[model samples]
Target chain A: MAQKVVEEAVVAVTEPAVLIHRIALLFSPGRHWLLLILASLPAFSLFATVLPEDRADVMYHRYDGGGVEVDGPSILVRKSVMDTVSLSANYYVDSISSASVDVVSTASPYTEERTETSLSMDYLHNKTLMSLALTKSDESDYLSETGSFSISHDMFGDLTTVSLGYSVGNDDISRNGDADFGDQVKRQNYRLSLSQILTKNTILGVGWETITDEGFLNNPYRSYRYLDPLAGNGYSYLPEVYPRTRTSNALALRLKYYLPYRAALSSEYRYFNDTWGVDANNFELAYTHPFKEKWIFDIRYRYYTQDGADFYSDLFTRRAPQTYLARDKELSSFQSHTLGLAMSYEIKPGFLQFVDRGTLNLAYDYIHFDYDDFRDLTRGGVVGEEPFYSFSANVIKAYVSIWY
Target chain B: MLTNHRLLPLVLLLALTGCAIEPWVQPYERARLADPIMSFERDPVANGFRHHVYQTREAARGAEGGGGGGCGCN
Candidate 1:
């Protein structure tokens, strides 16, 4: 025997180095030196084939007011099946066209098309996160459906985060040329959110929401006005009465900051209430900048105000009939303003070789609307000079995105 | 408005006492709070198409929350 084959080859290499030191004492301390350099790689391959991270986007929008016009196109898709899951899908379309001012003084001048679809899913664990969604919409006499759920958690280590949500909706309405006039409606929503991490460049957020509605909430081709005291001071159209039930609440606050030239600043505030006598306020401000490391820019501003809807009216100085009536200029008293701009660019990954990133975006907005007390029933009740209805609008967007 | 509902509970108790006096950040100092504009949704399909165009031109909506249904173009 050659010394008993050299002691059986040193007992087969010390029994695989004592089973890799008992699997590197079951990893800890930053994963035990990356599992001892992946067990000393030699023809390495411990199995890893995780491919997921795909995206696609497309959008186009345009809207103009006063003699309305809407335009559309939207599409989205996302994926990340695992590594904590993710998924999404969407499609939207609008294509409306009107002749506003109450559709050019009460009816006719239409073109419609509406569609929507959505689906979503998300999940993560280790401090939690969750979501689920569904939606559907259709036009030619309306239809809708919705469902949603949400959850989030992470506290005192993720510097706080909290969320909760719920949703439900169902609707079906008809009268696009009166197909036996159908109706139905229902809605519900609830939400809450919080976020912290306030310093290391700040961040803070808060939100609360609630909503509920039930049954036929008006709009069968709207119309309302009454006081036909012999028709010359003009005013006599009917078909508006609402309040089967409604409830609403909202609150929000947000802030973000970070600047050392990297740029960022944001803000938000909101408050709202509704039990039919509205009260609202909203404000927003934003700024963002980035350049050279792949361009980005943004600007924003918004402001809004509201109050009105305790049987809203702009004319209707009596002639009976009033147990809830509205001449819906979104239920009267209002104020609005918006201004926005955006830009984005980032694309470089060997020209889309399975694209690991890509983006190109553009945005614009400009809106204004003011009406202290909705008037202008096509300007016909000029007692002491009526006419207070205003409008202005423009919005445009373009998008492209890719990631894989 | 009732003194803004009594100053909204004293601004939510001074924003939860300024989140209990902040100061405790260490996860490698959260790299700019893990930027993405410190996301409160930095583009989720352009914030869901600007929240559906301000919920079809506002009449007051749930200041950024999700839910949809009921529309007669509003």
Candidate 2:
């Protein structure tokens, strides 16, 4: 009888040991263990409690640390595609004041204020994402807008993917009572991309983009200060001219690296060139780090630079009329840099504690812009110029979300 | 005044489009599929950022890939 009892105890210990070994084999240490547990909970529960599809996301942004200011609010909602295809749209209204483009001509340096709203949507499938998106903005100084459609397909057992999409739209600038002569633009774009899974933990992709635009292409709102043709004002601009047609081609590549436990590193670069003698380069990098339990953090940096169009010229140019085709900003090269940080934390949901999808997110981004000195040939002094001034703006966004 | 107002419909059209489609991934799936830093998520944000930058610096429109729709510029 004593021997029998010993054998039964051995069996009980051996069975649990086997089970533990199996679990460890499937879940590698560091982060996979946690993921397995988190991913398995829903699997074991078999979604006993479905999370509410209703969620609220909002972005309240304020820009400029000084006399120039901007404030706006935006929000988002997500519906389940499994049920009725998900939809999300955001709107924003902003008030502004600055040294630039004040339609009120009040000399207050703060007369320009505007409202802007943008909406985006997705027709979702289990494995495909088809979306049509649009954005529009109205301000005291100028009105700008665009609409687009994008599609993403998951292939190779969700490892490899392909995307093809297109967009067409226009940006019109107006103030007081007149549209910028030749300022209207009609355009269309085409895109093709290929994404490949380099490893279980890595993905790399390449893309091509093309755009063609024709029609009124003038910035009636802005001008190079020249002697007024009609009156002898200190500075007056000759009428701006529109380029009848323009085209652009861009190539881009992206890479993503997966680390332990939902952590990742991502980067991308793009090069663009146009028929009008303009060239641009873009580079971006970001890192994602997830803490124990349910907290995620993100840090990102971006750099961009673009050469001016051949037709571009500034306040004073030594070049003859042959070199000056008549667009103001087109002559000035431009560059920009951005830094961003964001975080998400999960906590108990008070209203629907029974369901398991609850998390809150906060994000902030800041950017700086400047125009480079490809300046005047005769007036050697970039001395009197501010080097295209500096613009700084920050936007903060917050969101509450749930998943089933 | 009427010509100036043509932009009004364009702005309204964009705001309306916001309701038609959404980012490929839903809010909840953001963590799993569309982390903010990922290319998929960053594309749209960068698209907007680039536009803003181009508007401020170079000529607003380029030779090739631009408009997201069929309508042409004025």
Candidate 3:
């Protein structure tokens, strides 16, 4: 019943995004090894090639008619003191020549040229609200560094607001591919927030986050080969967890409603627990309306579920596999559902200046990832060894922000 | 791991759904107004390019503000 084997594996992956709409026939090598096994990991090992001057994945795959051509360069600055303090800065840069991460398997997809940078500061007294930030990510494969701070108050006036924050990130990955889910990982997070309004229309937020992770969180370039006749290659070899350490806790809730003028309604829910034996829950919804005055409308829906990672295994393991390294994909702990539609058009092209503003946004998204413990690990290859590989993506973006 | 303590009475009964919102009190939102809503909507590089488009499609990321990217994925 796993939803009819995940709708027969997404009707068998919608016959290739509607079967060849052409982006050079959708760059295959197993769709670039499924986008290099989902963009080969490595975030806090600080893999730098000078990338981070603004690279929103090249601005959401920036203006494409296909056949791949992307260009992105971004920068931002903000300040408005007088009542208090506020300062901000952002920079992004990207240069990708995409061969889908230089195809050599182990989940390929990490074709260099990257840069990311971030800085932020905020301080406001009396009622309290504080912030400090820093981020740097450069990539040829991976590199990361992050710092964060936050504070908030207003608890006990019935309008409730409380926040406490912390962040630390470190990354290093790039020994050139072969990531079966091991290649360096370090993370630290602590957060607590509460926002309450309770009546005039429902505004609520609750959050508690705690994360402590240590070293090479796994993905050493990736691998999965099974050909067993009695371990003759029935597969089973994934040794390396790089000083693995994990602890996670999260509980989140958010709600918002307003039905006029800028019509709004929002929802969010999250629950998570971790220590290798992963468990996750996420739900989200959004509706934004603003038409005519520059037209704007947005709609969104999301749901995610997880449960897999006490060294999730598949390829027939009953007892001789306790995560001697794990990376068996079905995207581990499966369940992904998403539906989205967005539109934004705010133009102030009055020959620039007047606080130069311009925005154009269009989005369409549909996602489905489900695996009922797929378990097959290929023997005669019926696309099953736990077959469930479905992916669909679409994005369009436009930007213009000028403030001098 | 279960000191969600019955999640504090379901988070105080969902914090009574935080009574809805529409409180626009500016005069610089007083108290000097620093980071009012995460640095008053700081726009972390447009929310880090909307979080690199929600890590590759599928949308929805708290309209700018609070938390960001981390992956060991799974």
lDDT of 3 at A69: 31
Residue A329, model 1: Cα distance from true site in angstroms: 4.9
TM-score of chain B of 1: 0.33
Ranking by DockQ: 1, 2, 3
CAPRI grade, predicted model 2: incorrect
**Better-scoring candidate (lDDT), 1 or 2:** 1
* Candidate 2 chain A: 10-residue stretch with minimal lDDT: A43-52
Which residue segments of model 2 deviate by more than 4 Å? A1-55, A65-68, A81-84, A101-121, A124-127, A134-147, A170-173, A179-183, A226-236, A260-262, A318-331, A352-359, A374-395, A398-404, B1-39, B42-74
Model 2 TM-score on a 0 to 1 scale:
0.66
Best by DockQ: 1
Tens digits of per-residue lDDT, candidate 1, A1-404, equal 33443333233222222222233333345544443444354311111111123577888888887778888988888776645677888888889998888767677889988988888777766557677888888898888887888777765545777878877888888987677889888888888888777776788888888888888887888877776767775567778888888888889898888888677888899898889988888889989888887888989999988888888886677654678888878778888899999998988669658776777888998989898877766676565257788998888888887766
Model 1 reaches what TM-score against the true structure?
0.31
Clash pairs (backbone) in predicted model 1:
none
* Tens digit of per-residue lDDT, candidate 3, span A1-404: 33443333333222211111222223344444433322233211011111111112223434221122334766666554553566666667655543221123233333345677777777766456687878787876678877888778653432566778887888877654445433566787788877765553456778777778777655555554333456543443443332378777778787776554346677788877677666777788877676776766777788777776665554434334444545444226667776777676666667754444455656655556565554433223442254443333343444444332
DockQ of each: 0.11, 0.07, 0.03
